[model samples]
Target: MYFFLSHLSVCDILISTNVTPKTLQVLLTGRHLLSFSSCHTQLYFFGAFTGTECCLLSVMSYDRYLAICDPLHYSFIMKRHLPQFLATLCWLVGFFVSMIIESFVVALDYCGPNVIDHFFCDLTRLLELSCSDTKMTDICVTIIVSIIGIFQVVFVIVTYICIFTSILQISSITGRQKIFSTCSSHLAVVSTYYGTLIALYVAPSSGHFQTLNKVLSLLNTIITPLLNPIIYSLRNKEIRSAFSKNVLRRLKR
Candidate 1:
């Protein structure tokens, strides 16, 4: 229980921490906080954290794949130490990659009309606001999105395919049903998460798509955190049992 809470807290911090500085800056500047250096910093962290999340979700999906498809070798394959190592590597890579992209964005100066259209700091929105020659920034963003976002989506799809294929190979109908039940919750989450993510980042960023992008971003950002615990408690037998046990114990006390 303590371990789960600790991890949940970390996720909360990672997702919400970035909002504070930007909010402060906006309040101070009366909603026009797009200075050259500030814009660069915002874009850098935004890209980094966004990329980190994509990598983290892919890693989590892979963990589920190992747990379900190859339970016998799961521990050996993804021991505690390996997860920590992988997570650190993901953060480092995400930071450096985002930094490079932000550098490209900062190289182009804004001439006028620096009003960013989006609520939060995003690369494409920032580029759209730029009155300077933004072709370089656009190209860099396209490459990064293709490599990080699209690549992770493809990897997740492949992982699910493998997981479903393994489940189908089970001979007994009951056994197949059991396996599907274990994975269905994760599949739901992965589909919603990756689906919204692809729509937000991979789709063409235009005025027509802005509303859809904001909605999907809200789904991924605010909705997923609330849904995760509910999904786990409702779909996972062990978690449900644990909750019931805790509740009953408290009642008896």
Candidate 2:
């Protein structure tokens, strides 16, 4: 799980780095300006990292399913190299998917009025700026989201259903409680991450909530990364102990 967590951390870092610096620049300078290449570059990395993180969350759920449902063989199933292979595959798939979408975006003709309404470059906002036909671009995004996003969300749900069934079989109350506790954090993170995303992209609404959508996008890009470490790691005993020893102790001095 730590192996997967490390990769998830990397995704969050990439996402925050991709979006926040430019957002900060816009705020501090009061200039909401981005060059064409820079906007596209940001768009690509944002898509890539978000997609990778989606896959990673599903993979982590699968990891937990194996660990809880088949503890005895969990080590054998995960193996020494399987985690690395899975992580690498997630990265490659994300980049490939993002590249496809980026290509479609690049093909669109942005004749004039290239103002992006959002703080950073977003696929939807970018699509709105294009003068050419966006039907193809819209179709590509729908396909990708249906395949990668919805599929992964369903996969996690099914995996957890199996996990819950296995948990219920444990005779000891303490055993069931302990196992549920392990899953609760993952469920929280998944809910928050995917919930914000679904609200922003998948929900059907009008242009009236563009401002609200921007807030949701901020929650997705900025607040989610900020919450991840606290949700996943800080509550960990070893991490808390280390923080106390290293950080708190230094502050005391």
Q: 164-225 in candidate 2: lDDT tens per residue?
A: 99998999999999898888878889999999998888554347888888889999999998
**Best-fitting candidate, scored by TM-score:** 2
- C-alpha lDDT of all candidate models, in order: 0.71, 0.89
lDDT of 1 by residue, 1-253 (tens): 2232334435545655665556555657767555667666656776676667667667767777887788999879877788877677767777888888877777776777767765567677777767688876778777776887778888988998998899878899999888777767666766776777766766666868887786676666667656766765677678889989999999999
lDDT of 1 at 216: 71
lDDT of candidate 2? 0.89
Highest lDDT: give the candidate number: 2
Clashes of each: 0, 0
In model 1, which regions exceed 4 Å deviation? 1-9, 20-36, 202-204, 236-253
Clashes of 1: 0
Q: Which residue ranges in model 2 land beyond 4 Å of their true spot?
A: 204-206, 238-253
What's the TM-score of every candidate structure? 0.77, 0.92
RMSD of each: 4.9, 3.1
User: For candidate 1, what is the lDDT?
Assistant: 0.71
